[model samples]
Target: MKVGLFIPCFVNELYPHVAMATLELLEGYGVDVAYPMEQSCCGQPLANNGDSSGACDAALRFTGVFKDFDYVVAPSGSCVSHVTHHYPWYIADNADFQRLQPRVFEIVEFLQDVLKVDKLPKPVHFPHKVSIHQSCHGLRELHHASPSELMIPYQSRLERILQLVDGIEIGQPERRDECCGFGGTFSVDEADVSVAMGRDRVAQHEATGAEYIVGADPSCLMHMGGIIRHNGRAIRPLHVVEILTGRGGAA
Candidate 1:
């Protein structure tokens, strides 16, 4: 299958290595992939900020860029959630979005659901104890993990995927489903609250004796990581695909 890569703007510009790792992971699975340079924001920020017109412009551009691919896969559940769930709010009645939205999938979901992945990188040595930080979008919107509220029992797709790797131990934070407080613009408008929430999450993960915090969303990691660094803590925030791709320094 020819997959079109959709790296969120922040991932593209700030966390380029994560984007590269995602691509590398997919290629390692022997899937055909394409990264179109024209792709940009899925207008998530604009839509989150209630700027419909601006969001519409961005969504239209995104739809145009990945419209032709068999699948539009992104490393971020947050971005994919925005594009898949919110584009209709901005575009209202556009055909471009209708054509592209159904084919969009977050990388992990694509690998597990579409590709039926059963293994990960071999000869990888990751000895650190790591905790999973389920991004809100990934958890609730995508149901990447079974939420505490759900009566139906379902395993976390992420944790299972992580287990595919060798020499890795996974831990769950004290409160598994809580937000990291980086609700996109939530950090900017409510800086203190965001920081406190991030600090709380970092502390919870630290209590698990985890040296690294891994999640599907870099945005959450970037937020929690800032507070982690400011407090002189050694906790590392990483994207899961980084681990699977055997990105250098991961071991």
Candidate 2:
């Protein structure tokens, strides 16, 4: 299948390795993935800030860049959710463009749903207890919670894939689907509330006695990881894709 890689602005600039790991994982699964260098932000930052016009321009640019791909996949769930959900709302007039929204899949969802590999290319070992933080966009917006009804508010394809990895024990947080306080602009605008929420989330993870925290979206991990580091805690954060790519390590 022909797939286009959509690297969010933050992933391209700040978390390039996450994107790289995603590409490596897809290619290892014998999938044909292409990176459109012209692709930039998914226009989520603008849209979340209530600037729909600016977001529309960015959305048009994004749509123009990957319109021909069979599927658009991204490592960051929030970015994928933004393009798939928000873009159409911003550009409702373009019927053809709106159709492409459903074609976009977060990396984990694509791997589990499209690839459906019975066995992973390699074994991953993380001999430590780990807690997972579910990002709001991937959880609520993208309906990442639909797979499992176990008390956890969001159940993602990534969590299912992680179960296949060897020696990794996935634990749960206090509030399964609570926000990690990394709502893009929400963090900057409401600094105190953001930190408070993050601190609370980290505390719950700590209570789990887990060595690290993991999640599908890097933005939430980035925020909570920073708080964990600031407090000099031993627990670290990692992306779920990083684990699936067989690159599991502390933070």
Clashing residue pair totals per candidate (backbone < 3 A): 0, 1
Candidate 1 on 92-204: residue-level lDDT in tens? 58887788788999999999999998887454667778899999998999899998778888789889988887888899999888999999999999999999999999999
- Candidate 2 lDDT tens digits, 99-142: 67778999888887788776677777767787877778887777
Give candidate 2 regions above 4 Å deviation. Answer: 146-156
**Pairing residues by index, what is the TM-score of model 1?**
0.96
How much lDDT does each candidate structure score? 0.88, 0.83
Best by TM-score: 1
TM-score for each candidate, following the candidate numbering: 0.96, 0.93
Candidate 2 residue pairs in backbone clash = 145-155
Candidate 1 — worst ten consecutive residues by lDDT sum?
Answer: 119-128
